[model samples]
Target: MPNFKLTISDIKGKSVSKELKDSDANPLLGLQLGNETDASIVGLSGKLKLTGGSDKSGVPMRNDVHGSARKKILLSKGVGLQDAETGQRKRKLMRGNTVSEEIYQVNCKFNGELPVEAPAEETTEEKAEEKKE
Candidate 1:
């Protein structure tokens, strides 16, 4: 089975991840952007929602999330994440000493893997040997 990894990040620097096979994720992800060279094979279905955190009552907060028909998600690239905008205005309410907090605004992206690195030099080892009593 082909495995695809997805990384989700918020503006506040919080992140969540999910692993799904091509068959499972393909359905949730759209493919309208397949024709574009800049875009990847998977497109945002526009149904993805980010969580804003929760209230004192443990209720999940809600806010306005931005989306477009043209945005695409590159699963195995640099940032892996794409365009994401949190609502300018959060759902604010004030009453009974309960202070409303801003919800978490997040964007989803994907990760490829660690970049290849060259072998380390041994200059440090030589210097340490010279310094030994």
Candidate 2:
């Protein structure tokens, strides 16, 4: 059997080169970049596992608590969480209560032939058979 190794890099030119040895039982290796950057794999084959890794601060990755109202309140304000049943307006911790937005759009141009159209649907009338002679 042949051995497999790979080198993956991000758009910022920062790269991580890894060599897979038969002795290295762990088939998966993880690399974490900053929040603003993304890792992209190019020109390699075997199996690919691109995952978000540990934080740069050396702390373990945290699971998303999207449904927790307390977590949402804490994130929205720098103060402690509020009573869930109180129904009180939060004091905007930060200067502004605005949220920053980032948008990504991809546009590509291809000169290849158009894709083949799918076969037309057949109605019940079209499928009805003529009376045999």
Candidate 3:
């Protein structure tokens, strides 16, 4: 019953957002950072690697942290800490690497091309009806 908002990034630096709910998001449960999963569940043609994610409260997940709980760790330069001065460190609350129900946004890297859906062709009946008008 986990709901996840996925941020999928490709090699070209373009990013796409997708939302998965209930059973569609179950496959991502318990996955950790850097772990790869099949992207077909999300309609992508390649592999999708877990990069990072944030909980419902906006706390980020750090790769070095294990388990699925949140912790206050001393971070100088990493996923949670940004724009720090030289030799500066701070204890920031960040989530663990594992994906859990609390996680709201999941960041992923896609290894293949996105599928392009073809347009539906009009049937002869529809074409004939249009011609009559």
Which number leads on TM-score? 3
- Order the candidates by TM-score, highest first: 3, 1, 2
Ranked by lDDT, top first:
3, 1, 2
**Could you tell me how far off, in angstroms, the CA of residue 44 lies in candidate 2 after the best superposition?**
1.4
CA lDDT, candidate 2, residue 83: 50
Q: RMSD to native for every prediction?
A: 17.4, 16.0, 4.5
- Superposed by TM-score, candidate 1 places the C-alpha of residue 33 at a distance from the truth, in angstroms, of 6.8
Which pairs, if any, clash in model 2? Answer: none
Go through the candidates in order and give each one's C-alpha lDDT. Answer: 0.32, 0.28, 0.92
Error of 3 at 38 (Å): 0.4
Top of the candidates by lDDT: 3
lDDT: worst 10-residue window of model 1:
30-39
Write model 1 residue lDDT over 10-117, tens digit each, in one string: 335555555545465443332221111111333422233322233233333222212221122222211222343553232322111111222111224333222234
RMSD of model 3 against the true structure: 4.5
39: Cα error in model 2, Å: 10
TM-score of 1: 0.24
In angstroms, the error of model 3 at 47 is 0.5
Clashing pairs in 3: none
Model 1 steric clash pairs: 52-104, 80-109, 80-110, 81-109
Please give the lDDT score at residue 121 for candidate 2: 88
Tell me how far the alpha carbon of residue 2 in candidate 3 is from the true structure, in angstroms, after superposition: 0.4
Error of 3 at 84 (Å): 1.5
